[model samples]
Target: MSVNVPKPITALEALERAQWIAFAPFVFQAARVLRDRGILLAIERSREGLTLEEVAATAELPIYGTRVVLEAGLGIGLVTEVDGRYRITKTGVYVQHDPMTRANFDFTRDVNYHGIAALDAAVASGKPEGLKVFGEWPTVYAGLSQLPESVRKSWFQFDHYYSDGAFGAALPLVFAGKPKRLLDIGGNTGKWAAACMKHDPDVEVTLMDLPGQLRNAEQNLREAGLLARARFHEADLLDERSAIPTGFDAIWMSQFLDCFSEAEIVSILRRCVAAAGPNCKIYILEAFWDRQRFEAASFCLQMTSLYFTAIANGTSQMYRSTTFLACVHAAGLEVEREHDDLGVSHTLLVCRPRPM
Candidate 1:
């Protein structure tokens, strides 16, 4: 069944799924341990299925622990067993090797796991209550720089993996008008800015973000020797008084706007309109859950909203296109064109300021 519709299930089937949900935490941890302990790999490497003892020996784990985890993996469909032997299943292979899965897993484990308990409070208060796991901050963005090293790595890796894939396909569209000056709002790490400059030598790129984020971007650009080619503008996007710099030929916000609520999105876009010139094209790249071509992709996007609630920012979510379009309209901007299925699962909306 597609994510667009809920599957109809028999009573027994519903019970089965309920059971899975009940023990999902244990199954998930078992899968992680199996993947990390090489137990899954051991089974995969065996030309013939491996017996419990053989699997334990090959993976170099205690027999009792290996047996318990392997059985748990079987329930989760990560491994199969017959005739007292076991082998890795397709699901196990994905758990072990899928880059997206790796990114999502690390992000969940390192960034969201500890904080997830506060999701209820976050929902009730309309604030990132789980953010307390890291430090006292209004939102994750404010304290991102001071986050522990592993937490920071997972956050950036997860953030980049989703958005970075879309940039190559987006480059041609952004440069179609040969924009001389491009403003990248929420330009985390300046990856987009660097890409724009590489695509067009004469195009001047500016990255606008908070001071801490700009510091990270500046260091990255400097190490790549692209710092001289970029401009940095420090501003807190949530502060309405922080004026958006003006007169850019192109303005880009990639996977950026979803970090705010509907009202905030409109407020930011209105600012963009005020700063935009008559000829400026505003490009917004986002992963709208409703527009996803695959059920799996849509499911992932929907689940990510939980991260926003408990870890990232409480009030935002992965929106449907209709909801998002309303924000664009409310901001006094109109979408001129749309391009879907950009790399991975992204939709690019080409917009312009609505005429007064």
Candidate 2:
């Protein structure tokens, strides 16, 4: 039987979606407040559902605040009202409890909420205007170590939530050749370096990143007792002349290239190729927008691309798989192996320098 493909949304559905977008800020905070203030939890625990009075009492909130927020939740579809009672919908349940959703929500709230206001200007000027909210940095990465504690917590949580799961599945693929030396580019906080040391006792790992970033990463590796196996090479890749040290058996870039524009990525790849010896394998792991299995995941990535525009770096975007592949070819590299759906939403591209 032929599968029934979904058609375009009807006019009414389109209008509804438009309205949701128009009031997204209000709706987002309503859901956040509902979840954070315990109102949603109170409603979920009630088998028969909750009246505004009961919700207020249970959550220790004033009835006036409870009623208005729950009323907004009805419009947001996070809660439904029947016979003057409120209960959490399936989406509401996920919003309140799903780990990934919770992380993304907190990230949106704590990191992007105020900064996003400068999006239009950031786009117009091709600069991270939102970054001014935190400090005078060209990109968020430069200011990461200096960001407020809460912002740092949420940012790292969101970053690791997506990448950490892929490490367990990626380790074996990276070590398949039994390489004694490995280089991990953009090895933030040295988590991947530590994991590499733990995975193979004989392997020595070199972590390359900015000097400020290496400070935290080096400390972590030292505390984990992986310092002997892990070394640090600090250099800013944005500098055209920045050199990547040569002679490693394998190189790894996990969610790293997405932090750069297409041009920058190509330049960085060329540097990697220049440093790669014969028989060296280069691994590029990223959540390519076009490679996602679900449209929702793709949508999430596209939305995140805007975050890069307004907050992280204005030039970078979450690239399509095809776009990234072209950069690899431009750098005189070929994909020797491709791994997708490893964990969460990542795709791993194992590459080798093209024969001269």
Clashes of each: 0, 0
TM-score for each prediction?
Answer: 0.97, 0.96
The pairs that clash in candidate 2 are: none
What tens-digit string does per-residue lDDT give for candidate 1 at 244-317? 99979999999999999999999999999999999999999999999988888998899889899988889999
Residue by residue across 80-138, what tens digits does model 2's lDDT show?
A: 99999998999999998998898889899989999999999989998989989999998
Alpha-carbon lDDT, every model: 0.91, 0.91
Worst 10 residues of 2 by lDDT: 1-10
Best by TM-score: 1
Colliding residue pairs in candidate 1: none
TM-score, prediction 1: 0.97
